[model samples]
Target chain A: MSAMIKVNLDLLLVQRKMTLTELADEVGITLANLSILKRGKARAIRFSTLAAICKALNCEPGDLLELDKEAE
Target chain B: MSVITIMLPALLLYVAVIVWLFVHFKSKIFSVRSGTASTTDNRLTRLVYHFLDFFLMFIILVLLMMPPLLVVMTISQFDNPEWGIDIGVFSNLRIDLNEFAGLVMEPSGIRNPEFSTQAVISIDTYSLFAYYLFALISVIGGVVLLYILLQLRTVFASLLSDMALTPENSGRIRKIGYAVIVWSLVNPFLQYFGGRAVLRDIAFNVPGFQLNPAFEIPIVGLFTGLVIIVLSGVLNEAARIQKDQELTI
Candidate 1:
């Protein structure tokens, strides 16, 4: 089964006009980890991390993450 | 003269250490800390852990050397009358100590000896190997136990940091539990072999001591292993809950 929750970190980063590194520095996370989150490679992301990312990018959780309806 | 001089100080030190530990544990920092991970508690835990690690390392060293030491010491006594064992001393290779104290205290050349009764022990390459085999098996068991302890230490460390419900820790616990169970199952065979190794060779004229090759199965170890494995399922569920908690935004 494919992942139902899709990370829209790239779109949010683009909308904020920010580099992943810059967001990482602002969010107090490593650039490598930010890259993973942006690439949707992370198994799951922490709420605190997502909150920090949302806070840094001046966006809501919905803007950064979206739920793909589960496939039948 | 030498044994008394050396032993007196050593015995005094041993008693002192035991008393100190009793007092230390009875004192405030080691015992009274109740609620959570205080700095003092962490320090105490680390001190205990460091001591355990050091002691285990020392035991491992002794275990590693046991087989060869047993073979050499046992084989050395083949020609020596009274079957005395050598204690390696500084600048001396052959510092022999007899099992019975009367032999050591008395002057050479027996003039009306009190203890004439001899306890004869038969030894061949097979018997020596048997003894070596027992020590080697003990060493192997001890090494495996140490490996399990290392894994346990990791799990315990994670628990201390409040990461007890991680999937990695669950796996480590499961593996340790299984290792313990396996060791328990295998213990009887090792015990049997160890006892059988030297049991037949020893013919006792001395009273109050009996050698028996009784199989010792570790029922407690097996039970403990089972309990841990069963409890790991709860940890697995807790890990899932933690993962869900993490995923919540």
Candidate 2:
């Protein structure tokens, strides 16, 4: 199986013009978890929470996450 | 006629149907597979199982409805002097014309008869039929539910043994648990409302038990049953999630 793509929450927030603190507060997610999510280090995201974040940021899920092929 | 004369044949038919269905499907459901490649085959098997499950539920509903339908028919056909004599331990139990008339009239006149000649206001034949029907359905439903629970236990064990759980599967299990919980909560309320209406129509007056004035009162028995089912689902989901977490670690 191909390597699964990781989310880029920081890039998503930057594109949406939302600060880390603002996004974290709006999404009801902890600052630490938000930081981990921004750095693409989080293991998983719940679809419900993903939807909430998407709504809060006015961005689609694809804008926050994508798949990339691992280097050979 | 002996009670066994009527009950025995019905019992035999019930046993035969249950046995035949179990024997025919047991092997198909429990058969070991060589490879895990065929998603199509798995889906087909699941579809078949679901169909059988629904059929069994339908049988239960029919069994339940039979008595009420019979009773309604009997009540419609009820006549004034519809009594039959039955030989018992203490002479013949008789429902004579005068006794029947007395019972029908005594409710208005307020004179309690002596213990020996205490007129038994016989239940309408249809009502008796309905009582028996409900009793039979309750017994059968209880037994079938127990059997299904046992089958679920075995299937869950086998599935756990054969496969490693994933987060996706765990999520699916949780969703199933939620569905069961919702069904459990709703089923009893529906049954209770239906039952309460029927009882009211029949003018049922049990000595100790009284229906609450509030129509919105929850059916506690149904709620308890639902709680049990939802708990089982929650436990299964928890187990799946634990397995997934262990696998991830």
Candidate 3:
């Protein structure tokens, strides 16, 4: 069974009531990158980017990511 | 020397290389091995790359004999043994074999002795044009090789700094693969025609020993071409992955 690293960026963005563009601008990243993270397509997330994202949303790393144990 | 003797080691080498490749990439065949793409270049590495580029250019020049007078000079050496000139550069040169075609090994009349039956061929006279015909066939094959090497030069140039995942590099590699496969497919038939041309109208003085001409397929070249094409696909994937990783942050 293959375990996927799932992204919860969309949930945190919703709870924070922040648009993707607003988060992108505040984090100095592109909306495209946020979109990729939201869609679980990004192969990796850097610590700096993760820290910026956490600061913007006021969430821990666990709040933005999950271990998807379902076989895919 | 017989063709089999010359080819035995080459075939073995090919098998060994294939085995080594499989072993080397056992589980990572699908995954591109990861390492930091260093921007640093030592002087020695740069010098080696430059030297290789020049060597390739020189080889292409050698393959492109405008008048193919090299063939004439080679045949001349055969005619005049006193010349004893070394023909190392043009190792692929084909000499005339028309008039000297009366070659056949007779089965020993008695039980095969420890010493094999001696059937030495001593050529006294032969047609000169036969050499030209064979050499011409070889030259055509060389032309295809020349194209492959030229494309490879472009590849090396492109890969010096940038990776080999560019559209131009992909196109060049595909073209080289096609050219190599074409050369492999056509080489044997060229030999067949060359053999027939030389074998035609040739009289045999020996009673029962007409030497059968042996021709070979370019297995090594064909395999290499296939491998290059496969690697080109891998390179394209690697390029895509690289782009994805860059945007992952």
The C-alpha TM-scores of every prediction are 0.54, 0.32, 0.52
Instruction: Single out the weakest 10-residue window by summed lDDT for candidate 1 chain B.
Output: B86-95
lDDT of every predicted structure (CA atoms): 0.65, 0.53, 0.63
Fnat for the candidates in order:
0.14, 0.00, 0.62
User: Residue-wise lDDT of candidate 3 within B90-176, one digit each (tens)?
Assistant: 112222333234543444564532231212222332455555565567568767766776787677766665565775677788788
- C-alpha lDDT (0 to 100) for residue A45 of candidate 2: 72
Residue B189 shift from truth in candidate 3, angstroms: 1.0
How much is the lDDT of residue B149 in candidate 1? 75
Off by over 4 Å in 2: A1-72, B1-12, B18-160, B168-172, B204-249
User: Model 2 lDDT vs. the true structure?
Assistant: 0.53
Top TM-score prediction, candidate number: 1
In angstroms, give how far residue B196 of model 2 lies from its true place. Answer: 2.8
The better candidate by DockQ, 2 or 3, is 3
Candidate 1 segments exceeding 4 Å error: A7-72, B1-38, B84-130, B156-165, B196-212
Clashes of each: 0, 1, 2
> Rank by TM-score, descending?
1, 3, 2
